[model samples]
Target: MTVTIGFVGAGGIAEWQHFDIVEARDDVEVAGICDVNQAAASEAAERFDATAYTDHEKLYDGEDLDAVFVCIPPFAHGPAEIAAAERGIDLFVEKPLALSVDRAREIHQAIDAADVLAGVGYDWRYSRGVERAQELLDGRTVATIEGRWWGGVPGDDGHWWREFEKSGGQIVEQATHVYDTVRLLAGDVEAVSGAGSHRLVDAVDFADSTSVTMEHESGAISHVSTTCAAEDHDAHLEVVADGATLRITEEEITGTVDGEDIEESFDVNPYAVEVDAFVEAVAAGDPSPIRSTYDDAFDTFALTMAANEALDADGRVQPAAIDDGTDAGEADQ
Candidate 1:
């Protein structure tokens, strides 16, 4: 069965990752493309032979979509997501769910009430290397978890990401992949403490270099550091467990398990894997195949937001609590 898909944003990661992946799949049809930029939306629409619209509401109203990929920036998140959820359309959202925690919470509530299947773009969770790291660390005590995303300032779609208010800084905006992968390998973070410096980037007041320490609920300690100062790009997560030490990067997993050396290279494309997973789940009428569901990714958002708070306060901050909406509704009743 062909899963009909709509795109909420048509540039940068949307085109580079999602557009190409879905367009290559025979069982997936690109039904509509919507972006604030008319030229971008129209170009993508023309290429895919899909309809183009400037507003997501119009796309949602006009097209019979099985799922919509909400790829807008962090600040432009709420409206598209809420509208889609209200219409009972499944969603695949790109991460750092929103610039504000309250906005993310609201979107989460909408998805829950509508009973829609939603996936977040924490594509690293689907990496073969990450899976290998999980297998190696299973049934073992994880001691220290370390992750890093060292890279240059991103300028893909536009300069919107360079602004703090729009992008939520480097930790929340770009390195969130590291944070999500850390949570996947270690556990949910109970508290976040971090420090950052904005001396490097003049364009934004937020940090250009950041280091976050996360205390997992399981009593494990994890540290993730990010910097947009370097010219080279590197991202990876390393975990030290009872009997194994595993390092997972986008391309491979390498380290020692049971005092034996191990190395595994992955040729897999995580973007394709994640997209395929979402499409399959949409077709199967089950979201279990998606590794990063909306609520699950929200936890990662809360963690990063806590890190942001920690940076400003110079103290540990617990992640903002989120309810599944069941108890809150009953309380109101």
Candidate 2:
């Protein structure tokens, strides 16, 4: 059986993460595409010989697609997602879920009230290095971990990402991947302390860069410093346990045991893996390996929002004050 998939956005990451992978899969077919920008949707349709539309209702109501990929902006997610859920179409949406908790809750409610599968584009979790890191750290006495992701703003996307109000700054729009990765590898986040500056963009609600400190419940420490001000930018994760260390870069993961070094290149393009996983999940009736499921996705949003709140509070954003069910509270007694 083949899975008919409709793609809703046709841009950089959409192309990078979905188009390339789905095009190569025999079990998946690009059935339709919808973009408010008809030309963009037509471009994707032309490549797959599928239908294109400016209205998503055409895809949901008219087409025979079994699932939909919602790759629109953070703020543009809820309606498309609810549409898919109402139609019982499995969905794969891009990360950070939404710009606010209320919106995420709405989408999550739609998803939970339906009989469909859903996944988010947290591609990092599908990466081989990140998976290996998760595997190696299991049952070990973890001490400290930190992740950093820095890169330039998307001038390629017409600079739409520079607006903090739209993108939710670096935390919601970008480092969300890192935030989710750390929590998956470390533990439940207890509190968030944030610091950010408008060093690069002017009159934008989003920061050009930010630094966040995360306190986890498992007694492990984690810190994150994210910036988009540099050219040779990507991401890296470092973890320490019993004085030993494990570090994962974008393409490589390194582990040192007793001061002996071990490292290798990992081949997974988390984007490709995520697309494949979503299709398989829809077919087999399961969630994915790298899902930013609304539950976890909302947690990521909450943590980052709390971090932003912390920065707004002059770094006094204590754990007790954050109302988002993300921070650590009195663990016992």
Candidate 3:
């Protein structure tokens, strides 16, 4: 059966990852494209032989879609996912989930009530290196975890990412991959304390240098650092297990595991793999192929949110203690 799909955001990620991956598959068809920018929507629609709309409601009304990709920005997450779930259309949402934890929880509840298949774009989870790392660390006891996301500012000086309100700072908007990967490697975090500085980047209001210390429920300690003042981009997650150290970068995983030397590299595109998984799950009428569902992604978002809260209170904050007016503690449960 051909899976008819619609795109709710025709921006960079939609074109580069979701659109290209789905276009390559003969079992799927791009039915419609939506963007607040009419030109972008029209251009993407013409390129993919689909219809374009500036409003997502119209796209949903006009198309017979099995699923839709919610590729909007960090702050623009709620309405599209809720509307699609209400229509019983499956969702493939991009990361960060939302700017607020309460909003993300509502979206999660909506999807659960609708009982539709959902996937989040935590694409790093789909990498071959991650698969191997899980295999190698299957039953091992983890010690200290180190995660880093050091990079220069993204987009232009006036880009939305520069604004903390819009992007949720560097940790939430970009380094979430590092946070999520570490959570996958080590267990859930029990408490978090963070410090941040905003001295370098004049246009950005948020912290340019941020460091977080997490106390894991597994009795393990984690230190995650991120900065937007660097000239080069460098990001990685390293897990120091008993007698083994495994490091995961975007292109490869290298280190010693199980008392043996190991170095594995992957040139594969995780974005394409994740999009393919979402499409395949939709086509097969199953959700098991998706590695990161909305609920799972919410845990990661909560962790970042806790870090932000920690920075605010200048004290250690439990992920469950966030002031989003909900039982955020249940997110980890």
Candidate 4:
């Protein structure tokens, strides 16, 4: 069966990651393309032999899509996902689900009620190096995990990502990949205490640096620190396990095992792997292979939001305690 897919956002991610991966598949067809920018949608539609619309409603109503990929920004979520779920269309959403927890909860409800297959864009979980690291650390006692996303600010001047309100700050918008990886390696976070500062990048209001200490349900301690002030270092997760230490970056995992040096590199593109997993799951009618479902991504979302809350309170906060009018904590049970 040919899977007809529609794209709700035709930005860089769609052009570079989703489009390239989906276009290569023989079992899928680009059915429609929609974006708030009409030109972008039209260009993408022309390239893929699909229809273009500035409004997602028109695209959904006019096209018979089996799945819809929502690649919009943090602030542009909610309605598209809800509409797709209402139409019983499978969904693939990009990370940092929404600008607010309430919006994420609404999408969650729609997906749950529809019982449709859904996947989120925590693509790092699909990295071969991360998989190898997971295999090496499995059944081992983890002591501590340290994750960081230290780098210079991304995007050009006046980009939406530099805005706190629109992009949900760097922690939510950029550093979330690291947060998700930490959760995957460590476990579900129980509580967080952190502080944020807007000391750098005067043109943007979002914090340039944030430091948070997390307590996981597995009784392991972890800390994730992020900064958009430096471009000289690498972004990675370092896990300290019993008798060994593993450092996992986007391209490789390096460390020592049993007092011997061991290093593994990844040649596979995680974005491609992620897209393939979503397509295969949709085709097979099983979402089990999806490492990051909307529900699971919500946990990462909550954890980051909790860190933001703590930054505001100048104290500690439980991730499950920040109520968004949904039972987000139920996933822990």
TM-scores for the candidates: 0.95, 0.91, 0.95, 0.95
RMSD of each: 4.1, 3.2, 2.7, 2.8
- Clash counts for the predictions, in order: 0, 3, 0, 0
How do the candidates rank by lDDT, highest first?
A: 1, 4, 3, 2
Between candidates 2 and 3, the one scoring higher on TM-score is: 3
Per-model lDDT: 0.88, 0.78, 0.87, 0.87
lDDT, candidate 3, 147-212, per-residue tens: 999999878878899999999999899999999988998889888887888889887899999989
Model 4: how far residue 227 lies from native, Å: 0.8
Clash-forming residue pairs, model 1 = none
Clashing pairs in 4: none
| Candidate 4 C-alpha error for residue 70, in Å | 0.3
Choose 1 or 2, whichever is better by lDDT: 1
Model 1 backbone overlap count: 0
What are the runs in model 3 whose C-alpha is more than 4 Å off?
321-333
> Across residues 1-333, which tens digit of lDDT does each residue of candidate 4 receive?
889999999996998789999999999999899999999999999998999999998888999988999999888999999999999999999988998788888898999999999999998899888899888898888999999998887688888888888898888988899999989988998778888888877866877899988989999999989888885766899999997899998789999887988988879999999999999999899998899998989989988887777776644677743335743232221
